[model samples]
Target: MASDKSTASLTTASSKAILLLVVFLLTHTLSFSQTTTRTYLVRLRDKVSSPYSVSRPEQFLSQRSIQRRQKQNIAVLERDLPVNPAYVTQLQQAGAKVRFTSRWLNAVLIEATDATMTAVQRLPFVTGLEFNRALSRPVRSGGRLGAETDTKFGQVQTAINYGTSQTQITQLGVDNMHAAGFRGEGILIGVLDSGFMNADEVSFLKPLFDEKRILATYDFVKKETSVYEDDSHGTSCLAAIAATADGQLYGTAFKASFVLLRTEDADSEQQVEEANWLFGAEYADSAGVDVISSSLGYTTFDDPSQNYTYANMDGKTALCTRAAQIASETGMVVVVAAGNEGSNAWRYISAPSDAAGVLCIAAVNQTGQWASFSSIGPAADGRVKPDLAARGQGTIIGNPDGRIASGNGTSFATPLVAGLAAGFWQANSRLTAVQVVEALRRSGTQAGAPDAQLGYGIPNFARPLATEEPMAPFVVFPNPFSDGEPLTIDWQTINANASVDATLADLTGRTVWQYRYQPGKLGTLTVPSLNLSAGFYVMTIVSGDKRRVIKLLKR
Candidate 1:
């Protein structure tokens, strides 16, 4: 009895130490100054529910209840088989490269390469070859439509302004629309998460529920109607862009409706957990939900056999991708986490998020540098990913309880953008999902071109500018010129015969002056010397295929 007591005491101490570690980490991360709210995860103690009297695992997690029924083996042979230190040896014996090995999953996802996929069928114990994919992301909204109306739920928590600078998440193209009064009034967001606590008590959410905003909720793990306890991760994610309080955590869309789908199984590590997510999305779709943003992605599994490798991050390898794809096609804008594997060996975004057409978001720091943990991409298909950026690193978060905290992860960044998109849709309710995405993409600060690291850079809150637009030209010394200096117009382009596409306009797009571009064969063209006015003016060089718009300034 003494030994057992000692063991239990030691376990308790260990748990406490872990809890302290969590607090320490969160305390040290950078948080945005903006008062916003979202829910988040904390290392929590397990409160055990007594085991079933009978072997009725079906009571809560049966195939029908949880939708995690065991699936038939379908992965190709190359991905099967264990890989250890002897991975090379195993590959050498098989006459294959060692690249197939996935150290994290302790298994290999080999490729046939020159070998036909049919070769995999002949291999012993080999299942069918399955393709992996990333999920699709949502399109951007144009702008805000109105102020959020007071609801029975009182002031709900929102964290929209939390991390646009960090993660560079810009898919929320029309986030300003939320401020304009489009709060996803008729839309529904399904949160397939671990648990919920104090969700019923938030004031802003009361009106939504009272007005039947909460369509439905289901607990896949417990198969219950209530999921309002224990988990704070989903709540935090939801708050990133959806929560709203007058002075507290403000969501991009303070009035968006939500449905909590407790599909994640925090206790277990298996393929079935992924299956649960599919079921949750399916349920949400059937309920006519408008948008789905899941801050979850899977590549590595505790069990070696079920793990995915870097190459498997083709956006289609996992079950999650299959469902995420379907959700998007159904017209529900889907935004998925880009994964936090920046430091991991197989550090690329995982499935569903890697799926084609999904706008993956990478986390960034305040200075616009890539967040160390933001998932890397150039998806296996060779497409640059993280369609855009948003604040993600060390973002402030709200929990299931009315408590506020800060966190860092693609998980948090995703919802911030999602909420913004919801707000956009609310602003232009007539906009289709694809239209929303295009507006957001075009509205990007770097929409003219995109690459892997920071897909489209950060977003501009105003109307999205285009590369082809025509404007005026000006020569301002010390570009981004300081105030009070004679805005110098020294240039070969400003030669007597040369003409500058000199036309200035205000924010409202009214042409202040128009100076036509004169054809010139010279290497450079300069407009006539002139003192330029400031307060944001566009100076354009209108040469065919050479359209450059430079900003000017004056004292």
Candidate 2:
């Protein structure tokens, strides 16, 4: 009987050992699976209601933000609320490592194994899921990415010389606006791009730093605080707007305050970057920015399956475009690059540019001709896109290394236009964001006849500042005269002794032609055409304190 009990005990020990080994193997397999988990974008259907209230917007919005909305008659809606904390907890409970959350899209990015993802999808709040690529590798220190390069470093000079930037700013009449003391003072601008490498160290941007105009910065790509350590594209874009030095170089809105945001992942092109852009824009809105300048556009991605077709250029199709529209509705003027795809296969304006009510900028050369690489557009809905054009080809930029160099892309044009828009708005403080946009469109050389290639044509900042008088009714026929055609002006002179003076100036406000005449009782005056270049010209008609500015396009 003792021998039988010993045999039973040995059998029990052997069975227990086998059971422990099986459990260890299963635990190791589960650990391996978790480590190999993939990242995904999980969209939630709704958020928990307990923690947030749309009526109490002060909790989420700054005082300036609240003031801006009040001025524009915009309401703080439920969409502006932060994502519910309960929903995030639920996602975390499902073994999802949350990376980012977008209140605008009501979505959260998570990392989880396939089995865990399956479980996450089965949750009641989960509406859908998509595979998001792994985080892009961080750029190596001092490495150049995209169109930014460090070759121009060490070439910076101390004296003020305008350099190659003069042509770009002068062509848009931005210099005249500067002369009027409207250099973006009292205005806040948000610059959204990949990175802002060396911006703090550049000489031209020293004023922005010295005056503490860089109000805030955030990096959405790496989820870090160091935007100056990444790509230099943002540096170039900012230089186009806020870089200022005595005579050497000056940006369009040199005196404006700034909020620098790193929204793009320069290492990779993906849809996730668009979400980052949306988040950045929302942040900008909450900070009370008057304008947003975004050089990034989307259509193609590293994953071909995630690429957007031309059909998606519809104003609301692209997620970023919807965000831009919302931004416009929220009272901030948004400017975007029309795109540099003119020479590529997908030759159309990219999204956010297609968004309605936003100013889409196209690239033009110093000669005021459209750049070959500037994307063309009639948005999918048939609205003429690229509301304006700016000098982009060979645009001078203050590089990260303190050197001033030239770069080419619509990316440069967007900020040039954005800065000038700020100055224009500064000149007329009473103009709403929508009114300013309309004024810009009307100030374009081609306002009378807009086309897809150049949209309304290049904008003239000075033209928008002209205040109209109700005294005399003046009209110019065949206004967009050819180089050799005659211009006929008819006006109802309020006073018989009133002298009529006509001046034709280039975009720089330089008087190219001037004439003085006394209108007859018939109220008609015809001037023979003089030699003029094929470009945009401002025709200012002044008759005894009643002045009118007419934007003319010469063929």
Candidate 3:
């Protein structure tokens, strides 16, 4: 069953996926208990009212919806793409009937023919059009799973990415909590992946099982009596994310409980396979998953008719889109793998990963260079994707036979980050889903500025959430400074040759005051004592290494 991880020279990790698959079938393992399953009631509020109106649903993406709408008349369009609310306005103005509107995509997914499509394209502000063929019947892929050790489910790794050889997976942050012995005990995590055959038998996950932390696992793929029998991918993915050993490989969130969902169907191409993920995500919500980490994304399939062109990659183009959106709104941290189609002409991050609100992940090698297999992003809507990274190729995780295998893929990278997320969650359960997202982004290497390839850059838990006092003293004061009497900005000591610029800016493009200071200066820069109207102002210090911005109110 173990095949080389090569697929058309597709990229690295192809060989690794196979060897892990083979080791999976060879090991016979113990089973997991089916007792613990947390259920969450998924509630959707009215869109125009309440918190749901402003930030109810996060809009973190857009991609792919550019394909020519399929001309064939199909009944699913009603369920596929709902009528646009704005289109109703367009139709009424054009002397057409306005009946119903779509609250979802904010545009009408009309049942247009070739002529209608052409006419609609000519309409004003019609950003894009799509076929809405996403509503396919659900089909089980394959899920071979079993229970493993849950003993160390309480031990969380303090590092962002812990590699093999007992070294922290990342270089930047410090693991203060792990060092303090609070490694996420009693937290439950749900992992949705391909399959898990021998993962339960592996000794790595044995501790968690013994500790009774692995709540419950269901295989949506087979709709089976157990999730520990059909595939190896899910098991392997989970192992890397949460596995623990006796001075062996360490996981990110070792203490978190896990719910495993088998969504990918490596068997055949049917639009429903994509829909199955929707159902799985719904199930995940029902399962009360604190965190949902899926390394799955969709693009092309076996059926040419079902093939998704790059234009259709917009987060709104697929059935998985809504499901992913719903998952995010429900407050479950959703982490998805950016696809590995980077080198291919069809390469781009896949759907759901392109979905709004969830954190899309990219892969990076040990040397900190972007991996060639890691998909590039800027979702269809131009939002930076791959919000973070972890080790992919050469990432070491435990095998069922009590050994380790170095693997690769945005898949592996995803689990590693997911595990890190678990650790973050463990460190602070009071953190809301959005707050957690902000903290992760703010703690990244590229926090101040982000790009398409690595959204906010790598997630660093230690720095953003650190509890210790600042190493260098700094101050911003007199918030709500009335008429700018005198806004004093204090300076602090810093490294050699460091300089700072203190400036005050008004709402417009005008600068009120700008002052530069040397590294060791211990003085305050006063804003021009001008009688300004009530408004918002920005005071900032641009230092040699870092620039700090503080918002001031000019009352």
Number of the top candidate by lDDT?
Answer: 2
Global local distance difference test of model 3: 0.58
Model 1 misplacement above 4 A: 1-175, 202-212, 467-470, 473-555
Name the better of 2 and 3 by TM-score. 2
Please write out the lDDT profile of model 1 over residues 1-555, one tens digit for every residue.
999999999999999999998887776542321222211111111112323222343432323222211121111121112233343343335433322222112333333322322333343433333233111112221011001112222233334543222223233433334333455665567766666566667653445556666667888656578877756567677666565444345565546778788776555454545656766776675565666777777776555555677777676666677667656654567877777777767678766688765667777665567887787887887877767666677665566556555577877777766776676555444455655666566566567688776677655434523435444453445444433443344334334554556565543345655566565634343344444433334455554444555544322
Which candidate number maximizes TM-score?
A: 2
Per-residue lDDT tens digits for candidate 3, residues 1-555, read: 135444545445667788787676554221111222211111112223122222211221111111111111111222233233444555446433332233333433233333344454566656553343322333442221111232222223434334352333443232443443435564446677666667677887887678777667766546664777766777667776667664446676677777666666655445554555665665565455667888777776554666666666677777576678766665667888887877778678887788867888877777666777777887877777768766665565665555656566777777777766666665545455665666667667776677766778877655522323344565655654555367666654544466667777653436867777665554455556766544345566676666666555444
Position 35, candidate 1: lDDT:
21
TM-score of 3: 0.58
Work out the TM-score per prediction: 0.56, 0.76, 0.58
lDDT per model, in order? 0.55, 0.80, 0.58
Residue 76 of model 1 has an lDDT of 18
Candidate 1, residue 230: how far the Cα is off, in Å: 3.3
